[model samples]
Target chain A: MSLKMRLGLVFSGALFLVAVAAWIYQLKEGLILTNMQNSYSWGLYISGLAFFVGNAAGGLVLTSSIYLFGVKKLKPLAKLGALTAFANVTAAMLIVLPDIGKPIRLYNMLLHPNWMSPLVWDVIVLNLYAAAAAIYLYILMLPELTGRLGWLAIRVDDPHAFSERWAKRIAPVALLFAIGIHVVTAWIFSTQGARDWWFSPVMAPDFVSVAIAVGTTVVLLAAALAYGTGEKYQEAYRALGLIIFMATCVHLFLMANDLVIHSWYGNAETHRIMDIAWGDFGPAHLFEVAAPLLGAWLLMRPQILGSLPRLLASSALLIAGVFVHRFLIMPAAYNNIPMTMTPFGLPESHWSLPIASGRFLPGMGTFLDQYAYFPSLVEVAILIGIMAYAVFLVLLAIARLPILARENQ
Target chain B: MKMGMVIDLEKCIGCRSCMVACKQHNAQPPQTWWNRVFTPGSHRHLTPPALGVEFFLPVHCQHCENAPCEKVCPVGATYHAEDGAVLIDYERCIGCRYCMSACPYGVRQFNWEDPEKAHARSEYQEKYHYGYPEDHRHEGRLVYSPLRPKGIVEKCTFCAQYRDKGELPACVRGCPGKARFVGDLDDPDSDVSRLIKSRNAFTLLPEKGTKPTVFYLPPKAKEV
Candidate 1:
């Protein structure tokens, strides 16, 4: 390994260790250590779940679409996409362990699953997606594996042809999974009528669009990192950049559509949610919308896409923006209390329900009608740890696996 | 056999006895109240919402026929009893808190810390634990327990320990204003059913389509 790669592994390994320590502390103390109370029950960790699910789904979608669409120029980068999908899906699954109050009782989710729940569906889809991603990655790498191993001659008479045929068949299936994973994840939030902010039909489509945009960005980063910004890969990079821009446009339109509907309706619940999202969490929301747009704009530039540093930086902006987008999900929905019943047909008579925060500090308000929730230091540590784990896995796979084309070629 | 409650707002003094009775008998740790009462406008009790007339709204688990909480519980932890009461199995709850967001009334409370650690007794009340110091199971599910485990969600069981024993819920029994009534909503002759008929009772957030068993009589101030 290169000196930087060794240093990178050490850094991620250290962050992963810190996450373990924080998780242990969280388990012992209970969820109160996090800022989430009854009102803000879904916090940063849930956001992380959605975010990484988007990443995983997007990465796989990029890999599988290449085979289905026959993007021969993008073929070298397909392995990176599959590898990221595998690693990120694992990270998404691990992140849920810390968010749940009782990890010991996780088996209950499987043993006595409530089919009515969107959460149960998400659990099932996520697991299936992870398994499918692993198999797809292995098959996509089969030709490479068979070439390197003489023992593989017994199993397959023609490994290259077998891989080509199988990867093609699996591509459509993996693409369906990509759509299914994000749709199911978005449904977990949107199915609830309680939080009107999350109760829109548009959310599912928007999630898919965001997934493609973010996933393509992931592939682009992986490609540029694995292969220098040489003329050989320039055409493929241009094609990938176009995918990110178009998908981002779709995502933007969906967001604006939701915003117009909410603001136009102008109900108390709608007004309050918009106000909270824009007012208290304004900067995060700004970044959520701005970063990806800017990233896409930069990718649209012929000059920027030609340079490795500029390409990676653009991808970083997109990732950062989407991270904030996922984090923004909690505040707008949770802050707008769901109790909108009018008493005696008088809207003013409807009182704000101050939810018990499931926390008590001597001087603070114990019951909160609205809360501006921020993740505690412990939660932040764990979130970073999870990101590091994903990074470590991606770097390790790239280093160990036959991810890039053979150097002699 | 649909168990429910009806709170008469006109008779309610907003004394918050129901809140206290619920907290004590339910063995709620600090920062948890299965039932709470507040005026419409102010944090203070008895502050009128409009027309300078005082009335209190006591909100808790609605025991809805179409409970969002029950629908969203991934593990079948929150389920409806045969008697139409929404109950949670503490042992079954995975502490995901999805049900907390799904409930419109915001009555669900999670044990953020170990209940024993949070419910630290003061010197004046040495070694004395509050609530019906016994575990209460309904239909083979551990629905009500004094020492609840941390991380799981808990809410008003309508005092299941007392209800299962053929007694009124503590809130209904302890209300000084006699404002709270509990009985079978399914029975035409029951107090809750009659009150709904005679008082033009309504449930909170009816538009949510939850079909809550609990009802409330509009405050007389509206008529005035």
Candidate 2:
């Protein structure tokens, strides 16, 4: 086996082992292994869920380049990005399974769904988006499949097959569908009026912008990894950096806007959450603030980060920034000011403890473990396995199929 | 017919016995309850400290006729029974927590972990046992001792189990202040029915259109 294949197998196998170990520990001890408690039910799994969903947003951006704007240089990336969407949504779904108490009976969500709940709507949208994303990528690849497999698309191949014509013809519509998938995902969270943190007019756009930034970053990383034998994918890499740079600017603006809203509103919940972001939840803040700032600073002068090493480092930093951004948008939204607790400056005698009230506070440990959900080693292995498998699958499809036009010698 | 609860804000002593009784009867965990008491925000923050931090409102799932939670559930897991009680099917919930958002009153709670670990005292056990006819003791011990399962949403049921037995909810009987009044809206002769008729009762967050069944009678205006 080649070195790349060997590395892929080793990486996948190691992740598999760790995930399975975590799963077993969680199953035996229940949620006690994790720190998730009553006050904040959502932790790492939910955070990962949001991150993965956001991660899929770039596939749409890639689709737009090829189908919407007729940018042919991105044709090589369309199938690869679609495959990433599939891998990500799958990872998100599996992570959520262990997060809930009754992972065994998860089917009840579909069997007895609550129509009005945003969560239920989320379930519908996630599944639909996954299906649409998968099909959109596959349909675009049909022509490629027919050219290479011969037997895959149909038994016999005609050079000018009608199916080939249809595949190219409808590719634009599939691209549009891809854009809808992530936009609707943003709406699901934004519509919740109770949590002031999530109630933002720009949340949908923010979600789309960051998705493209991270997605393009991942594409660049993958391209560099593929060219390890010293080949240059310079054109695609340059385009990727430009896209990331622009998207990073949008992403930063959105973050500043959210803070501005919180300060301007000065409501109890909003201000309390702002305090948590700066004070107790400092690690996440560090990631969100530092990574992007450094990434942008390093990449700000394109000439310096133009080389492969600089590009990879910048991508890594940006990816970390996006991860912290995911955490900010998710778990932090659950902050509340318990009406039972006396306002901080109140007199001691006036401290009236209510007979019954729910108290909200910052939970301990990595937010993910609190729900008693530690992603099982099996889950992590599967996640790593799927990602490796996706990379492998995309590479094989691209190499063997006509996903990219044959280059002249 | 509208079945509801009337709480006299002035009479509440905030002893939290009602909260305890709710957990005891419902077998809920210590940190979790369908009913919670809220001491009114301190009026001391006002320009003058004349107003006192007077009343504590005990709240639960209002069993709203126009419940926001019911409309938002994608799976239709939360719904109202014919007798005007909001109900949940524990076995069916996916724990998505969308209902947690739809509820403006913030009553619904998601079970982040298995509830059994936190249920310290099993008061629900007593209600399930046999009790006397004349007194609440006639009812049997509360059979439901198990805490709520994880990955499902749970809230107050207005003691539906006790209602099925033609008895008052545990909190109604447990209130030492004698401030709670629960009755069938269909029965005009019931004391609660008369209280609703005589007193100017108001539902919290009525503007949200949940049409909450829990009514409040603000402290009677002080005599001039």
Q: Could you give candidate 1's per-residue lDDT for residues A292-333 as a string of tens digits?
A: 999998987878888988988999999899999999888889
Proportion of native contacts present in model 1: 0.77
lDDT of the structure predicted as candidate 1:
0.84
Per-residue lDDT tens digits for candidate 2, residues A263-323, read 7877555666677776557787878867876775565445534566776788789888988
DockQ of each: 0.67, 0.29
State which docking tier applies to candidate 2: acceptable
| Clashing pairs for predicted structure model 1, backbone only | none
Candidate 1 DockQ category?
medium
> How large is the i-RMS for each model, in angstroms?
2.2, 6.3
TM-score of each: 0.96, 0.80
Candidate 1 chain B worst ten-residue window by lDDT: B119-128
RMSD for each model, in Å, please?
Answer: 2.1, 6.3
